[model samples]
Target: MAALWPLWGLSPGGSFWQRFAFWADALDPLLLLAPADEIRRSRLLLQNSGKTLSEPIQDDQMRKAFLLSLSSVHPDTDKIIPVLFRPPAFLPICLPLVIVSSLHLQAKATFFSQFVFHSYTTGFALINGNSTTKAEEYSVQEKQIFYSLGAISYAACIGAFPLVFMNRYTMKSPLMELIVRKLLPAPLLGLMSAFTVAVVRSPEFEHGIEVVDRNGKVVGVSQKAGEKAVRETALSRGVLFGTTFFLPNVLTYFVQRAKLAKTPRNLAVVRMLFTTLVLGGMLPASLSMFPQRGEIKRADLETEILSSTEEPVLFYNRGI
Candidate 1:
């Protein structure tokens, strides 16, 4: 009675009718008949002083049978009423918007990928010199620069979403036309911004000083040591930044480009190639930097000293 009252929202007159209507509508689907059976059982119980139609059977067994019958029937109009007859309250309320908005993501990804392949990668190769001696040196340095710029570029591109929205709202035009017109430059901007940042930071590589011991002797050569440090930094930062911010935008670009191509074979090839180069490459590089990998998690000198001191504890006498 208490539970039923709450279900009725603490009122009897209006609540009773609402509750009755809800149940009737829920049962109206006829998909299941358990509700009708339960209603009949309730009526019989009221008329017969707590005795059910199956009164010859034990209460526990009869209750179990009733529950079994309820569970066995499929929900339908014939068996029961529909709850909230207009539409399912929860059948992906966002689905229509998603279908409508999918073009944006696709356009963004397409623009981003083109910018990366054509501009970012190519620009660096030219600036750093593509010859063998320069190539070997610059490959390592270029990766480090890429690590920093990738995240910033990706974020800036996504930040343009407000403009995309503005275009949609202001123009009394088809969404596809608005998208194509507004989003065409997304990839070029994303790639160029990332590339420019990488170039600016490249000079920072030469400025690091060498670490010295108490004796004033250089422990390691400055440039070599700096290279190692930078590599470690890049390993930790680069691929993650690229994958999270860069890859999705780039994928959107590639997908849109494929759509524009209008050739199924070309689209499939482009998608596979993009996935292989962007996502596939980024994953392994990111995983390689995990702190859990091998000796990367090893304790520093202070920790090692502390660990060494603990070895004597088990042998020490408490009495002393």
Candidate 2:
């Protein structure tokens, strides 16, 4: 199985059978059913010699029916759904993203260029929005602040995109295991990217809404003040982000451990480490330098500061 996985990850130009050999090997067992009739015939012949012919004949027919039902040859399509669609359709989406994201570290420009042209072209934007002011006049500090804020906002929005789509898709999948195995990674990365970006860009320990009364009395209430209201909206979403990123991998590890029984399995630690490294490194830095609403207005006052913060937030961790 380990040997077959590397081949499965291959995308080389090859014959149809060659290209799909790994999947074929993995699925062959499920596609082929045991010979129930042969087993039933053997049992029937043996029973007749010892017991009664009629009893053995009746038993064989019942056994055959049970086997058929288990294999889902009946009217309902329940049993066939898992084998037919879940693994075959879903794993392809996952493996490619893993490969792409993993390779981004070594071949940064090439990886990004390919992804932009082939996969993310429609979404990529070099310079978004209209900033009526010219780029030259602003000081470096001002420009840096402007870019940081934009990157966080963009990253957060991208992170939120998958949650919007996946809630319905998860319901449609035939198997929960298959969904967890296949549909994770990309969208999980999205939400993590959003949280990391938003948290980092947003000022540390400065969460609150600004309110100004009619008489010009200004008040800044902490996030704690409306904690319940925000929690009601964001609680499930926050859990979903952590679970999708961490839980599926954990489940997969245990499932493998159960099957292998004797193999060493301490990968959960490594998995957690990698996740922490990515979230900690990229998110915090990008957000810290991000601009406030005041900073953008001040960009008109100094161009150099605005340009310094203009670099991409995605540069740190490109959704691994």
lDDT of every model, 2 decimals? 0.33, 0.31
Q: Across residues 112-163, which tens digit of lDDT does each residue of candidate 1 receive?
A: 5433433333232223221112224566456655754554455435534445
Candidate closest to the true structure, highest lDDT: 1
Q: Among all windows of ten consecutive residues in candidate 2, which has the lowest summed lDDT?
A: 311-320
In TM-score terms, candidate 2 sits at 0.22
Q: Deviation in angstroms for 227 in model 2?
A: 43
Q: Estimate each model's TM-score.
A: 0.22, 0.22
Number of clashing pairs, model 1?
31
Looking at model 2, how many pairs of residues clash?
23
Candidate 2 lDDT score relative to the true structure: 0.31
Which ten residues in a row are the worst by lDDT in model 1?
311-320
User: Which sections of candidate 1 miss by over 4 Å?
Assistant: 1-103, 106-160, 163-238, 241-265, 290-320
